[model samples]
Target: MTQKNNHTIARSWDEFSEQLLGFIISRIHHKEDAEDILQEVYLKSINNIDKLQEDSNLNAWLYTVTRNAINDYFRNKQKNKETITQDIFTEDTDALNIKDSFCCLEPHINELPGKYKEVILLSEIEGLKHQEIADKLKLSLSAIKSRVVRGREMLKEKFVTCCKYRIDENGKLAGEPDCQRPECNH
Candidate 1:
């Protein structure tokens, strides 16, 4: 490798290693596995450094590599598993809290216009694939996809209007909603 490229890689490692490791750990509960993924990300960044455009953001590029590495790790794990176990797919507390927070949106979802309501119920609540939803509804796959997207947009608008939910700068739902209805209590 060229001296300048080596220097750039070293600099990136010094800056992003800790943050990348933390990101991996947040997704993967096992510390050892997270560390391994972090190392793989580092190696990938080293090998692919030259392919990165000169004007491209280095931080964003490294993050993309780290995310891909984490995904590969999970894919390999899934392929090797003969059967799924609760422990292997356990939901972290944060995920559970997020799910619970969305429960208040149930009533608002029902209030949506029929077309959107049907698609959202099947896709989100019933956990069906888009193709499955399309087949069941006898609609084109593109139509089903469009409905799901539009349904989510409508749902977000309802959350903002009915519940007074505000999105923060990061686009995440922020603060407690002023929900006074009995159905919104959950």
Candidate 2:
């Protein structure tokens, strides 16, 4: 990129990143992922700066890019989630899969921060619908949904980062954890 464009990007970063950081974090559950997406927004905006119709629209354009990045994160998360299932009752799932896959899950859940822990326990363990959770927690339906999504993503992050586990094609946690992270022993 040219020096002028580089300067422009630097200026943009200074002007908008602080505002967008909170905005991005509001939608994203993981702090590292949210920061990564914010960086992506900056890079994408710089690369596509010339395409923007007006200089005045840059702020809005950045917001658009940040929003799209968050959407993509959730979209990919959903696709990854599709390759993992909690349904151990199905004949195809088998008892072995359940016994081996979830040995560390309860401990990880116990380690979760309060709100995340609460939502996961309520939805997954207590079998409460999102609406029912909303009623009981006195949270908005959207807030309840957001908490559930965030809670699951947080758990998935822990599994991926600490346990080094990935969901197999058959929707089970496959392979052993690397045990590189301090809390990764499984």
Candidate 3:
């Protein structure tokens, strides 16, 4: 690339980082994930710097890249079928029915053998793309995709089973129990 083009790319990147960061953050709820997406955007922009022309349109180009990344993230998430484990461990144990209703999903996640757990965590928690997960795990794209699918199904079944059997001593439904769990109290 010419020096002028290089300067333009650098300037445009710096000017748009803040807006791009916010845009990515809004799409992905986690702050850390948003930051990681921003980093990916920077890397992608740098690698494709040759295609960027006309300084005025730089913002639009950057946004397009971001939209693509976000779409890829969601598509991978759906392919993976990963359900976020709602954590409710810190609350009072007096509501064992409720506690049992909401057991720690980390254990279930831990049960996933091999890269399935890693793929699910990265795709769901870290908001990474399939390609990103493949790169991170040094596995083939097909392998990553497969793991996400099977792993998510396993988690869903596990969560459903755990939630179903949860009942108070009085045999009442956990959700309609006479008392509230400490975590839900607030």
Winner by TM-score between candidate 3 and candidate 2: 3
Best by TM-score: 3
Model 1 C-alpha lDDT per residue in residues 1-186, reported as the tens digit of each score: 677877988898899899999999999887987998988998898898999888988889999999999899777654332111111112322343334445555576688899999987777654578899999999999999998878777766665666565655544444455654665563
Per-candidate TM-scores read: 0.44, 0.47, 0.50
Using lDDT as the yardstick, the better of models 2 and 3 is: 2
TM-score: model 2 vs. ground truth: 0.47
Candidate 3 residue lDDT tens string, 32-108: 76787888888887788788766558779889988888887767654433224222222233454444433334566
With a 3 Å backbone cut-off (N, CA, C), the pairs that clash in candidate 3 are none
RMSD of each: 15.4, 15.9, 9.7
Q: How high is the lDDT of residue 48 in model 2?
A: 80
